[model samples]
Target chain A: MTTARAGALLDRLGRVGQFLWSGWAGLAGLALFAALWQAGHERYGDFILPAPLATLAAGLTIAADPAAWELAGQTTLRAVEGFALAAAAGAAGGLAAGYSAATMRLARPILTVLLGVPPIAWIVLAMIWFGSTDGTIITTVLVAATPVVFVGVAEGAVTRDRGLDDMARAFGAGPLARLTTLGLRHVAAFLFPALTVALGSAFKVAVMAELLANTGGIGGALAAARANLDVAEALAWVLIAVAGLIAVEYTLVHPIRSEFERWRNAARPWGVKR
Target chain B: MTRETTDAAPSLTLSGIGHAYLGRTVLDAVDLTLAAGEVAALVGPSGCGKSTLAHIAAGVVEPSRGRVARRYRRHGMVFQDPRLLPWATARANIAYPLRLLGLPRRERRERAEQAAQRVALDRADLDKFPIELSGGMRQRTAIARALAIDPDFVYFDEPFTALDVALKRRMQDLVIEAARGARFGALFITHDLMEAVRIAHRVVVMDAHGRGIAGTRAVPGKPGGRDDGTVYRLVAGFLSDDPLFRHIHDIDERRTP
Candidate 1:
């Protein structure tokens, strides 16, 4: 038993090593993107597009200020809060609609209407209601992100294996037991990708709402830089915003998603471990 | 009930069971009974609603009209697809019903291991997911899952139809051995006369239109006692000489009402 436990630990270490080793590919992709930015910088000159290194330098300068960390943290907190609310609400609603034909019929038209309204329009409405507070940014982000999660979860629940459901029933599992044991696990596959998309939009919508509502965050900094016409600072704030997004996605979302979908990795061929 | 009376009562009984899909009838007036420790194979052509009947009997489907009385203490089902949860390890899948029964984690693990051993699944393979296991291994895991609950009655819904010939034979032998050793009653649904002959004490044929059962024939000996030659000869005789099997292989996809 000790040896088996040791073996499992080694296996986990190897997987972690593999995950880190795969970072080279991500780094290469980012390098190619930086190279493209450099090309654009040379073509348009400093005013239109600053060099990638120069933007990085400006981003570093902003990072030196403790106040700027608060700004970035503010935006991060709002986006994460919005994402949590959206995930909870969407998953609950999606499960309801997925299981009940009547609920699905009722929710479909409402979902279409929600999706039809642009985030900007919702931002404007939120600005009037909540007025330059975290609520406006969070509300806009919630509206923008919820539908994506709802649709993904619903699709997951709808496409769940009836065969497994029947198997559980035959084994004497009650409705609640079946949902907890089988239903949630199946829905996780569909839920993860939807959550990734929702999180991305949550951050984007939060920034937009912050700027429109005159709330202080990365977006407000960008507005200030725009007025000053400091293209480097504006670009630096943009970079910082994107970096924040990547950090949260990798640290929080992707790890949780991978945990849920570890079986899918086993399904892949050995040569295609990533 | 007393142990004597319980032993005498049928493990499962279905009477006047009828089912429909939307408005179309799929099963009608199906009355069947399984005595204690009896393995009965219900055979029919494709789309003849034998699967539906099994589902109804297992209480997985609500029949439009019927009464189902399950006297068995507990039951398990093996589906045509194996129906192992894709996300769970083979061990976890085997332990699922036990978990539902609120067995402690330690006992669940112990019983799941024992059940896996009965199906001849490797201990190492228990940690692997369904995707990592071969088709045969997955089916074995499904069987192991069924066996884990220590059920008195089992529902086999074409469990080995997807396996190749040699593999099918091995699985059949596995089921035969499991039934004999465990002494659990089973309702095995299948389209293969050879399979039915190999694994069951009696073979029940369903009507083509799902109106009701057509007939039943008792096999010559107990399951797992017959040799290959006897099984093959009996199946061949039934296919060629028996009127009950005349429409067994018939299929027309457009014939569904």
Candidate 2:
């Protein structure tokens, strides 16, 4: 019993050590980039390039303002809402297209047309319909993100292990049970990566749409800062938005992704020892 | 006194079973019967539709113009490959059929444990997935799964062909022991005559053309735990000089020669 307890403690220590190592690496990379930015500022005047400290001070000022939180929250809400809709629609559509050749053939042309068009092209059309509202921003994100998710899910469905499906059928698994258990389990791996990409794209597209439409958000605040020739403030808002994106990715997406990836990580072939 | 049904009537029957793939006939007018409580081993050369026959019997394939009647309540099958779900552990794989039948979780796990014990699978291996298992263990897991449902009719399609000699013998003994309980009947398909004589009550040799049964031989002793020497001479002599057995055995020789 004592030995078992000791072993458990040792394992915990090892995990802690690994976590610290990764954290140190990330901090080191950030420090190196900041140093380079500071050096560039010293070489060039503040008019051309702001110092790293100046950027950080400007970012702190914006972060203290209540309006910045409201704008950040708006952009985040639109991005997440649009992403959820795209994920659901893409998965459903992809399943239908993947399972039936006829449906795939019918949907192929439509998917091609949507995927081919640039997100900028949809901006004007979205503005006309929604008149520069959050609806336009959400629509822009959906247009940019849905096809990426569709292709991932469709490939996942097409490449599903038929043997498992046959076994499930032989053992009398009903259609819904099979879909929930086997179909979704197989698609989860592909869907998660696609989701990460789509989530990232949603944030980018929503911000772009807000900026283009001159709506009230961080994007609009950025435009106002630029109009006032407050380059430091503009860059600071951009930094704050990026930091928010990183925070969301780490807290929301990364944890969920790692939960799903544990299985994959366990299956990976740890390199052969010499 | 109550009169029982005739034992002569086949428990399972296949009449004029023929299968063709793209105008090429693989099995032609094959008539076969499996008596209740009988263990029959079907042996023939490669591509003689041995596996195909097993598949047809297991209802995985539908013959072009044939009917298979089963007097048994349920049929369980083990293929040449173990065919266990790679993601599921050994215990879970064994309990798959029971899960399909909607048994409660406790009951399923209990039955799976019982089945694993019967097949001599160690307790430590129960939670290990297919990739973590040895080849013989995988096959043993497959056998346990087939037996977990207590199937009245079991079809084994070259199940031991991939195992090492010791593991193969152990598996063969397990099959024989299961068959001897009188709870199940089996249709064992293999190309090995010695294995056929060792385990089966009656051995039916299929002709090369897959037309009909070429020959039938009754094994002298009980189905399971028979001494190897008792049937060794008969099997060896038939395989060496008997013209009917000779035709199928010669095919293996010709390739190597």
Residue lDDT tens for model 1, A1-274: 7897899899888877887788899999999999999999999999999999999999999999999999999999999999999999999999999999899999999999999998899989998999889999999989999999999999988998887888889887899998998899899989999999999999888888888888989889988999999999999999999998898788877778887889999989888878
Prediction RMSDs, each to the true structure: 3.0, 4.9
Runs in model 1 deviating more than 4 A are B1-7, B251-253
lDDT of 1 by residue, B45-141 (tens): 8888999999888889899998999999888899999889889899999999999999999899999999999999999999999999999999999
Q: How many residue pairs clash in model 1?
A: 0
Show the lowest summed lDDT stretch of 10 residues, model 1 chain A.
A250-259
Per-candidate TM-scores read: 0.94, 0.84
Residue runs of model 2 more than 4 Å from their true location after superposition: A1-54, A174-176, A261-263, A267-274, B1-11, B22-24, B207-215, B230-232, B249-257
Question: Each prediction's Cα lDDT score?
Answer: 0.91, 0.81
lDDT of 2 by residue, A47-163 (tens): 877998999999998899998889989988998999999999988888888778798889889999998898998988899999979999989999888988988898888888775
State how far residue B176 of model 2 sits from its true place (Å).
2.4
Residue B207, candidate 1: Cα error in Å is 2.4
Query: Ten consecutive residues with minimal summed lDDT in candidate 2 chain A?
Result: A265-274
